[model samples]
Target: MTDHSYEFTRAITRRPGQSITRGLRAVDTGAPDLDLMLAHHADYVATLREAGATVTELPPLEDFPDALFVEDTALCLPEGAVLMRPGAPSRLGEVAHMAPVLRDLYADVRVIEGPGFIEGGDILTTGREVLVGRSARTDAAGVAELATILKDWGRPLREVATPPGVLHFKTDCSLLDGETVLSTERLAASGCFEGYRVILTADGEEAAANAIRFNRFVLMAAGFPATAERLRRAGYEVREIGNSECAKLDGGMSCLSLRL
Candidate 1:
């Protein structure tokens, strides 16, 4: 039997560095507080460990300000790991750094080798298929390259569009389980999740959409009580983590790690 997409036995995360305050963001709320981010990151790693994942905590990469958002560099799957070619010029080099790390963990690691760019943040794997959303950072050529790679692995790839202005596809949604997704109404309205069960974030808590269902726990950003309660009422064991600092740079629970 295939492992469910969320059933991860391990995860890879990087510690926040002093350069994290310079992480990219669509809207600069303000510079992130590095001390606060580090404390919160510790809690995030702890939560993942608590959920039974053997977390690989990589050292901080000060050269890449957004290096801590490791999810954008690669896609981790049961079959192998695929390195992404980020659309963001500054983030392109981040993939090279992650390649060796993934190589150390997987026997079959592939690279996008793209003339087009894709980011791991724009890809979401479900029990049935792999969905790739074309955003400002993930283009058509990139999706096509990814589709070709996944095809070789016997995984079907579906092309979709990220909501306009959203940094990444997952910025507006996340897989809750094999067939269910937690999403913002705006993205859900796009009909991208046609066959899946969808749960919309609370009217004023759209930020809560980017969550991760890791093992037995659904980790979400703290402070979205309505969304958290909605998840709980749906029978998910939810854990909230401080996201204030990361939020300033448009990072969230799902952005912090690569699980496999």
Candidate 2:
């Protein structure tokens, strides 16, 4: 089966700081570094366009300075967009703000209303199946509900555990293609991401493992010398953009934006 063609969009927030998650509160939130982080995010978006994708920038959501919210929380599907009820209570408002923006782009927009919480980052799709990771941010009930919503659309859903200490499944892992995945040694060793061809990275290079593959270009951080070389050697045209500022906030290439 052929994968559905999609485009990605992101809101560039004036507040380009690192995220403070429920688990990790010690994250650095230095102020001066934000400009550099915003620049890197712009570069990443530009790289996507260069790779033949149509990227549109949404107006900056300045009210929410930590606006480069994880792309997964703002779940987007081919038929429409699903505004997630962020697992984190503080982030719930983000979905309400994102709904109108997505509605303008898509003919249909929906919501995963909560008695249960779900984040977009926990959801990943391969055109045929939707994989939902049961993480700190996504509940099992959310997954089951999502599965039911997608059933008639021909998108089967699979649930997997994101495991502890990992931000999200896609934060530590991403599918480069139907058969090829880029992941950190931590996730690969867990034996949870088994059954696929996995490319593991070296220690501390796990941040670079979370990348976005749009068209033929791979969006990754600017500084990972060895890992970038490895991807190039594997025949992918890699785009290394600086996202150090976002990194400081626990954000990576895949977290900052959502592709429709």
Candidate 3:
């Protein structure tokens, strides 16, 4: 079997004012603090490169400071990539910006154009199957459309409800490996994700919930000291990087880039 390791790259959000105007407003108002967050994103890009993965810095989309917008709108697979239709109307342009980048990496690239909207952040795929979180940001039409595309590649797709109050599917639950899953008690208790072996966090740290696995390594946010330590003790080599800026924009390590 072929190893499915991945590298990640992210575009830094330069003009917060321009990006914020297009989507939901930032909850935090400190301008100086927000600048620091942007700096942290720069550090994140560097960390990925140091880990021996190829890293590319895509130029910021003119006028779309939210152009780091890549995470909300696309998914990369071994064969090709699926361009997502962002649920947020303002974020639709994100797909156009992401297509060329993906094409440069894979030749069989395709898209999920709509009639339906999907956010890449809500989708997760493993060796067994591809799973999508049915949330406000990802609709039924989008899920059905994606299922059709995956079928062509011989990959099965499954859907799980990301009920109200949860961030996203992977945000609450993530596959740690083929047989183990790292999820919060809140999601596991809801009886929504019933089949996977559950590993719960001692305290409620939603930020720690979103993680990206590349080969044998997992990338996580540096700020969550307790949560990071816990995962480290579990025999997983975790790479912690700062993501304060992305967090201000409601983003996480997994949301900053697509790994494939």
Candidate 4:
């Protein structure tokens, strides 16, 4: 099946710095508290470890307000790592910082050098193929470039559309297993996951859609009880982490780490 997307042996996470209070947001909900964010981040990393992953925790990058959202920096696959070209200008330097780290681990690391832009958060690699959403942070050219890269690894890339106003594709969906997906109704309604089993987030608990299925646990943002219970009932080991501060910055479970 060639699927390592959900079952990961390791993960990379960065601590949230004081500058995270100034992180980018679609709407200014409120400023994130560094203390609260750090606490939540710790829980997130610990949960990943508990799920049987060797988590590499990196120090905070104060200069990059959104650096804690490491999932946007690169796509970690069984084949190798693909460094992303973020659409956000301020986030470009983040890739440079992550490059060395990934190079140390992967012998075949590739970069997206282009007039186009793509972020790892916009990508979803299922068992059968890789799906990429063209969102505000990911363009057609970037998707094309990524497709070309994946082709060499004998992977298929399918271009999809991110729901309007979403920060990234994963902000509305996640792979649950080889053939199932947990997604917001709005995104599933788009017919993007046609052949896969789709579990829609409980109505009004849409934010819960941005969850991740790590090795043996489904890590989700705290506060969405309905969605959490829904997943539990569906036979997933659910772990809820405090995400109040990260939520304030439009960040969620999947944004905190890059699993490989």
lDDT, candidate 2, at 220: 81
lDDT of each: 0.93, 0.69, 0.69, 0.91
TM-score of 3: 0.86
TM-score of the candidate numbered 4? 0.98
Once fitted onto the true fold, the runs of candidate 2 whose alpha carbons sit more than 4 angstroms away are 5-26, 29-32
- Candidate 2 structure, TM-score to reference: 0.87
Residue lDDT tens for model 4, 1-260: 43587888889999988788789998998888888788888899999989989998988999999999999999998899999999999899999999998998899999999879999889999999999999999999999999999999999999999988998999999988888999999999999999999988998999998889998899999999998998989999999999999888888889899999
List clash counts for every candidate, in order.
0, 6, 1, 0
What does each candidate score in C-alpha RMSD? 0.8, 3.2, 3.1, 1.0
Clashing pairs in 2: 8-259, 18-249, 19-249, 72-120, 72-121, 73-120
Candidate order (TM-score): 1, 4, 2, 3
What candidate 1 gets wrong by more than 4 Å, as runs, is none
lDDT per residue for candidate 3 within 57-116, as digits (tens), equals: 676665565666466767777767788888877678777877777787788887897898
Give model 1 RMSD, 1 decimal.
Answer: 0.8
State the displacement of the C-alpha of residue 41, model 4, in Å, after optimal TM-score superposition. Answer: 0.6
The sequence of per-residue lDDT tens digits that candidate 2 reaches over residues 129-220 is 67788888899878777877787667788888786777677878776776677888867777755677777765678778878777667778
Instruction: Rate residue 103 of model 3 by lDDT.
Output: 82
Top candidate (lDDT)? 1
Task: Tell me the deviation in Å of residue 76 in model 3.
Answer: 0.8
